[model samples]
Target: MEGKRLYVGNLTYSVNEAQLRELFSKYGDVVSAKVIEQKGFGFVEMGTSEEAQAAMDALNQTVFEGRTLRIDEARPMQPRREFDRGGYGGGAGRRY
Candidate 1:
């Protein structure tokens, strides 16, 4: 992997940061682990690209917590922008 960060998907809802850290630590030094409880996914930051790749190779498509894991290089997040409703019904009296 080119990036040190890995995107972990298809995670079980009960998985947490500590569990993620413990899992990835076997491959190499884990910089951080963050599990989004509601999204059912998380990001694991490894100390190096090699470690990230190793983790990906070893864990991707493997079953964890009764779910198949989807592991890949984490992509940079895109900037968020406010959407324009284009004057679509703001209220009972407003319509276009």
Candidate 2:
């Protein structure tokens, strides 16, 4: 693992940050845990890369909260580009 952050997927919608933090803490120090309720996924940050790797190894494909978990190293967020509406007449102009 290159980074301490891990992307946890296949989580039950009911899972919360506290539960996630407690689960990952078993492998090592957990810096933070965040569960995106609507998305059914979350991110966990460990204190070190080794810890993150260990957690990933132990937790991936494991069942939790009635769902199988998917764990992987978190990827960096891609930059968002502004959409151009040149020909679509998307500005303040004509009422439909």
* TM-score for each candidate, following the candidate numbering: 0.87, 0.85
1-96 per-residue lDDT for model 1 (tens digits):
579999999998999999999999999999999998889999999999999999999999999999999999999999986554554433445554
Per-residue lDDT tens digits for candidate 2, residues 9-89, read 999888999999999999999999999878999999999999999999999999998999999999999997665565444
lDDT for every model?
0.93, 0.93
Model 2, residue 19: distance off in Å is 0.3
CA deviation > 4 Å runs, candidate 2? 85-96
* Number of the predicted model whose TM-score against the real structure is largest: 1
